[model samples]
Target: MSERKQRADATRNREAVLAAADALFARSESPRSVSMDEIAAAAGVGKGTLFRRFGDRTGLIQALYEARVQPLREAVESGPAPLGPSTPPLERVPALLDAMLRFKMDNRHLSMALEEAGSGSPYAAGHYTRWHSDLEEMLRQIPATATTAGFTAHALLAATRADLVEHLLGEQQMTPEQVRQGLAGHIARVLGDHGND
Candidate 1:
């Protein structure tokens, strides 16, 4: 095969693996139960291919999680109001929290997998650091939170953690709307009116 064809095949295989892993995690009772062999078979690729491409199970899960969150990242990085960098901090803080909450709710399994991956704390994950940094920067712009931005960012993110989301949705039976409203109220209390609701 030509170089271009080889690249295309590799790309297709990678996507296929991600999709298969996503499905497996979504329906899995426990993320740990979904093995690399299952993922390889589901993707119709050789087991060696999965190892070669992703390094290991944690690496594959991280890549899949990153792929899933790419659109949200883009919106937060460059899209319009509320999520974009151009939005006012007062509005952006709540918007960012809400978006993240929704993301965790929507991708509970995958988020859980990524969070539980490896022996390190989830707070040490690259994605967590990026989100915390973004949130802290926005918080610093709001006078009310500026003094405690770092701690506030972490506290706010804790509200949207995968395990918390799963508990609210699964055990407490809170609707997505309820969780969102609760978060909005919490943020409002933190930010106050300040000419921006």
Candidate 2:
């Protein structure tokens, strides 16, 4: 095959694998139980192809998670108010947290898988670093949080962690709206009333 054809085939295979993995994770009772072999079979690709393209299970999960969050990343990077760069810090901080919480809630399985992957430390992930950096910068813009922006960012993000969300939704039996309200209230306290703005 020509180089262009080879590249096209590779891209298609990658998309198929990601899509299959996504479906498996979505339906799985536990994301960790969804094996690479299953994904390969579902994608109609060889196991060797999966290993070659993604390196390992963690890598495959990371790619799928990144692909899933790409739209949110774009919105936060350059979209409209609340999530975009132009939003005020006070408004933006809570907005960002809420968005993240919703995302974790929506993609609980995949989010949990990614968080639990590789060294079992979400902090070790590139996505975690990016979120922390963005949140820290936003917190720094506000006078109340400027001094402890880093810690504050981490604290805020902890509320949106996948495990915590799972616990709240599954164990605590809190409704999604209840969780959102709780987070809004917590953020309000943390940011002194303007957090809900």
Candidate 3:
């Protein structure tokens, strides 16, 4: 009974830590700014407890990322609709890009972290590979993407990355309409030029 109680308490503490981590990840521009002390305070645990549980700040951040963002990745790949199926590769190509971009725009802190990691982080690479493969499969259907879905997949990456959108909007001050047109034009040129259908 004592062990059971201890286990329950630990579970509660872990959940609290994850919740704080999630909030911090959303609010912070960099994972470095979010400290173990803050997470401990937010989780209602001692700093020592946080260290013991997570081993280090990066470990906690990584766990928080896995807990929070992995689901979004899975949903995009396997969940449903525009992302899952029920739509052709051409339609899905843009829709998936748009959805991912929106998710990143909405979750900037997490976005920043992942962007920083890029291909360095295994989890980040895995997610991108899935997106690239999915896009390639779709690109296979279109003539432009037809010859080499891999090339088209790379093009889609260029068109949809959040950093690029932020650059176009925040720095260049391009209107939403301009951004939309640019993305569409990019997709069209890529697909229309070699597009079979």
lDDT of 3 by residue, 1-197 (tens): 69999999988998899888778767775655777788899888999989888887766755665676676667666777767766777778777777766665565566555555523654246556777887788778765567778876887786766667767777899876677777777777767766544
In model 1, pairs of residues that clash are none
Cα TM-score per model: 0.95, 0.94, 0.73
Give the alpha carbon lDDT tens digit for every residue of 71-149 in model 2. Answer: 8999899999989999999899889999999999889989999888887667867999999999999999997788888
Instruction: Report how far residue 74 has shifted in candidate 1, in Å.
Output: 1.0
Taken over the whole model, the C-alpha lDDT of each candidate is: 0.92, 0.91, 0.72
Each prediction's RMSD over C-alphas, in Å, is 2.4, 2.4, 3.7
Error of 2 at 11 (Å): 1.4
Lowest summed-lDDT stretch of 10 residues in model 3? 115-124
Better of 2 and 3 by lDDT: 2
Estimate, for each residue in 1-197, the C-alpha lDDT of model 1 and write its tens digit: 89999999999999999999999999999999999999999999999999999999999999998998999999999999979999998889889999999999889999999988999888888999999999999998987678788998998898898988898999999999999999899878767733343
